[model samples]
Target: MANIVIIGGGPAGYESAYVADSLGASVTLIDYDAPGGACVHYDCVPSKAFIASSEVVSNTRHADDLGIRMPSPDEITVDAPQVYNRVKELARAQLADVTAGLAKTKVTVVRGRGRLLATEEHGSHPVEITPEGEPAYTVEADVVLLATGASPRVLPGAEPDGERILNWRQVYDLPELPSKLIIIGSGVTGAEFANAYTEMGVEVTLIASRDRVLPHEDGDAARLLEDSFTRRGMTILTHGRAKTVQNTGDGVRVELADGRVIEGSHCLMTVGSVPNTTDLGIEEAGVEVDDGGFIKVDRVSRTSVSGVYAAGDVTGVLMLASVAAMQGRIAMWHALGEAVAPLQLKTVSSNIFTHPEIATVGIGEKTIDDRDMDVRSVTMPLRTNARAKMAELDDGFVKLYARPTTGVVIGGVVVAPHASELIMPITLAVRQRLTVQQIASTFTIYPSISGSISEAARRLIEHDDLD
Candidate 1:
């Protein structure tokens, strides 16, 4: 049996280890913290736990809109410490669950910092493990999977102080709500936090370097989200790049590149992320990295070195947790003499967890533009759906793209309540190359938001007929 040693128990590392073990390989998983990685322990699970509480605030506040009497706005209060406690509790529970699963799978879980000691021309390497509060040791492995993940990118002048100034990972420890928050960056991370805080009654100002929020998303979806944010009293600063952040006596001041200054009780730097490829001896092990320090890997997740593989954020592919897991699995399968499929990025689905989530899959507008593909698209607004009207939600739409000639679904985007769930059918349609007619013929629940997807597909067919 092949012995696999996986580094950094994030989604990439742990998932890879599990897959390798299931494939009859002896696996060792090494991570300094819990096995679930940052996604489960810090970013995804914890943030969503906080968002869940904030969502309660929003729902209670909006209950009256649905003809249900809610407590007076003045009588209602959000206990931030309680919310933060819940976030931590949930994270700990999840970490425990992941640890238990690893134990059940018989994957050896080593708690420590793992580094590559040396690599042979082919097969096996010596990995050094430095355990916290324990002696350092070494292990031999036939294959070394590097899934070290990435850390929050810190700007030169806007470093996180873990107090008034924070990054996404550090935001969970906030004991109380900020009176006024200045979020620097209008990406997915920034937008989600802005939505959560605003719902929790915090004054939020979002600074966007791009002309609009979620510049990478569908333009219509971005505009809808921006409009929703504004309606909720969020102050959005577009084309404003943060030049520096200075800690004031009581708060902080953010200076924009254009000489504009914004002050707030707290500042969140949602800038970006850097791969955790430093000092782990990646280069010394004969692995090649890109200019940005992300390890270079092929579709099969193979690095330049024969026995070394890289996955997840370290490879700079799609940074979604799901994609990371897939990459890890592919790496293990390809390394072993097993059936494997190279990563197909086009089949990946991504979601932004805001008030009204944005989920998408397959080719997008930019892809269409760049490829100059002959396709047609139709959008159906959620307001037209009976369920949305009943739920008093009118801030989303479903958009589908299809080949005009074959009517095959190529891509889709959903912006609605639980858009992440609503996009799955469209995702299957795209991945399986289902035609618009096939999707339209499928049964949809009456008066449901997902019906909009089929309605959009039908509209595309009608548009095609006109041409």
Candidate 2:
């Protein structure tokens, strides 16, 4: 059996471990934390748990709108401590589940920080593992996969104090919810937290450098979310760039580049993320990295050095957990001499978890316009759907893009509650290169938000027939 050693226990590492072991490879996984890495311990899992709690709070507040007469809706309040506890509990449970799954596999789990040692003359790679408060040891492997994930980017003069001024990872440690929360950056992380806190009854101020939030996402989706945030009393400061943040012992103050100062009970910074590639012996291993310190890898996840592969946020390819897992699997498949296809980034689907979620797959409208491709597009508003009107949701739409002549579905965007779930069929259509007629002919439950996706595809088919 081939010997494999993977560094970093995130989705990339563990998922690859499973694949390698199942493929008759002896795998050793070195992880800094639990098997799930930062996603489970700090980011994705815990944050989603917090969002779920906030969504409940939001739904209860709007119960009257749904015609559910309640005795005292105003009396509903979020227990901040309880919410944090629950988030932590959910993260722990996920970690336990991941650890248990690894135990069932033959892959050996090592707790430590791992770095690449100089390649041996026999062509076997050696990985030096340094366990915290323990002596360092080296493990030789026929193949080595680097999956060290990324960390939250910290701005100059705005370091997280873990008290008042905070980063996304530090929010769960908050003792009490702030009366007013100031979120810096209007990207996915920033928008998600701003929406969650606002729903949880905290007055939120979102600072966006762009004209609208989620500048990289679909324009219509961003506009709908921005409007929803404003209607819910969340203050959005567009075209505002935060220069510095100061924790004044009690509250936090943020200074903008355009000579503006904003104060709030707490400040959360969601600027971006930096790949955790420092001191991993990239130069020693002769691995090439980009100017931003991200390891340069091709679609097959091969680094500059042969037998040494990289995946996940370390490779800076999309940075989603699902993408990380796929990259990891591809690397193992290639290394183990299994048939593998290169990663197709265009077919990858993504979602922004906001109040009304925005999910997208395949090509975007901007890409079509930039390339001036011959594409036909159609949009169906959720307000026209029977289920949406019955649920009192009027703020989202399903958009489909197809080839003008062949009518094959190339891309789609959905903005609505549970858009993540609703985008699956559209994602399948894009991935399989299914035609508009195929999606239109597929039966979607009547009165469902997903029905809008089919309706949009039907409109595209009709447009194609007209031509």
Candidate 3:
């Protein structure tokens, strides 16, 4: 059996460990934290738990609109402490579940920080492991997979003190919801927290360096989200760039480059992330990294050096946990000499978990326009959908793209409540190369938001037929 050493316990690490063990390899998984990595412990799981609570609060506040009148909808308030407690509980439970699952496997889990020692002459690599409060040791491996994840990028002047000024991870430690929150960087992380907190009754001010929030997402979806945020009483300052942030003992103050000062009870910096590859000895091991310090790997997850592979956020492919897991599995399959296909980024589906979630798959409008691809597209508004009307959700849409000549489904975008759930069929269609006619012919339940997907597909077919 090949001896494999996988570093980083996040989605990429643990998922690959399972794959390597299943392939009858001796796998040793090393991580400084628990099995689930930052996604489970700090970023994705905890934040989504909080968002779920905020959604409940929002539903209660809007109960009267649905004719489910409560005694006092206006007085509905979020129990911040209870909500945070549940978030922590959920994260811990998930971590325990992952640990239990891994226990059944032959994979050896180690709690330590791992770095590549050097590439040996005998085609074996040595990894130096340093466990917390313990001495350092070395493990020899036939193959080394680097799944070390990324960390939140901190600004020079806006360092997170874990009190008034915070990063995405530090918000969980907050004692209570801030009275007023100022969010810097209007990217996905910034927009999500701003949306959740605004729904939870905190005054939210979002600072965007670009012309609009979610500058990287679908333009139509971003505009609709911005409108929804505005309706929910959130302040959006477009073209506003944070020069510096100062925590004034009790609150935080932000100075904008355009000569504006904003003050809030708390500040969240959602600038970006940096890969955790600095101290991993990638340089010493002859693993190549990009200009941004991210590991440079082929689609098969193979690094520059033979017998060395990289995956997940460290590879800088897609930062989503699902992508990380996929990359990790690919790395193991390739290493174990199993039948494996190169990672197809075009078929990857991703979701932004906002109030009205944005889910997308395959080719997008920007790519189509940039490359001048010959494609037909259709957009179906949710306002016209029966289920959306029943649910009193009026602000979202479904868009489908297809080849004008062959009618094959190339990509899709869904903007609605639980769009993440609705994007699966579209993702399947994209991955399977199903045509628009096939999607239109698929059975869909009436009075459902998913019907909009088929409707959009049907419209694409009609347009193609006309052409």
Candidate 4:
């Protein structure tokens, strides 16, 4: 049995540790925090729970339009703390389950700061870990999996104090709701919180450096989201980069590059992430890292230094929690000489948890823009469908792209309420390379949002009428 040492107890590290332990390997998992990682304790579960409360508020407000009356007097309002408490409760429950699973697998959890100790005088080559306040655990392991995750990147001028100014993870701590919230950097995380908070009755102003929100998403989809958010009283300022963020006596002030300034009760920055790869003695171990401080790893997640591997946000792989988990699993399998497939980024699916959500997978329009592939596509509006009419949803659609010559599905985009769930069928098609004809033939409930999936594929199959 080989000894496995994993650093960072986030989704990536804990998942891999459990897998390694199940495979009969002796494992030691080290994390400064609890076993659930940032995703559980701060990022994923907590954020989604807060978003769920926002969903409730939105649904309550829209109930009358759906002919479903809520008889609560004086109109329903937000309870930020209770909502936040609910988020914490859910996170705790999920963390409990995850920790329970790790226990069952017999994975040893070490709580402390873990640093690599050099075996040689030059401080080069294989590693021995020096844990905080404990004996120097000289781990002579068959393999060391580096699953250390990342943290929210703080732009130089916009530092967060976790009070009036904060990042995504710190928002839940506010005792009360901000009367006005100014959100800078309208990327995926930024857009998501903006939408959720606005729905929960916070006046939100979104500041973006680009021309549109979610600049990384499909152009049309981004435009649609901008329109939708605007309709919901969200003030969007594209091309307005935040130059300086300062706390005023009443609230926070953001001076933009364009000379205009805005103020709000709180400023939340969601610029992006920085990989947590430094100070782990990776460089001393001869492992290569990119200029951006992300560890360099091969398709199989192997680093330049043998017996050392890295995965997840630290490697700068796709930053999704799911992708991080998969990379961690693949790393363990490879290091243990089990069956493994080289990482294929193209097939991974990710979703934005915005109202009228966006989810996608496989070959994208960006990749196909310059190629000579025989691609055909169809965009079918949800408003035109039976289910959408029943639900009274004004925004969303199913867009599918396929290889015309081979009839194989290549890419797809779904924009709908619960679009995340609806995109599963399209994801399966693209991953399996199933043709538009096959997707069209699949059965779907007539009064369901997923019917748009088949309808969009059918439209692509009959392209002559589209023009």
True-structure lDDT of candidate 1: 0.90
1 against 4, candidate with superior TM-score = 1
Global CA lDDT computed for model 2: 0.91
Ranking by lDDT: 3, 2, 1, 4
lDDT string for model 2 (10-94, tens) is: 9999999999999999999998777998989999999999999988887787778888976464577889999999999999999
lDDT digits (tens) for residues 158-276 of candidate 4: 89988899998898889999999999999999999999989988899999889999987877788888999999999999899889899886799999988999989999999899988
* Candidate 4 similarity to native, TM-score: 0.95
In model 4, pairs of residues that clash are: none
Off by over 4 Å in 3: 71-73, 464-467
Clashing pairs in 3: none
What is candidate 3's CA lDDT for residue 399?
93
* Residue-pair clashes per candidate: 1, 0, 0, 0
In order, the Cα lDDT scores of the candidates are 0.90, 0.91, 0.91, 0.84
- Model 4 error, position 424 (Å): 1.1
Candidate 1 C-alpha lDDT tens digits along 1-467: 88888998988998888899999999999898879998888788998888888888888989999889989766779888888989999999998988888888979888888999767655679898888789989888899999999999999999899999999998878879899999999999999999999999999999999899999988999999999999999999999998999889699999999999999999999988899987788877888898998999999999998888989988889898999999999999999978998898888989998989999999999889988988899989899999999999989999999987789898999999788898899889988999999989889999889889888877887874523
lDDT of 4 at 149: 88
**Pairs with steric clashes in candidate 2:** none
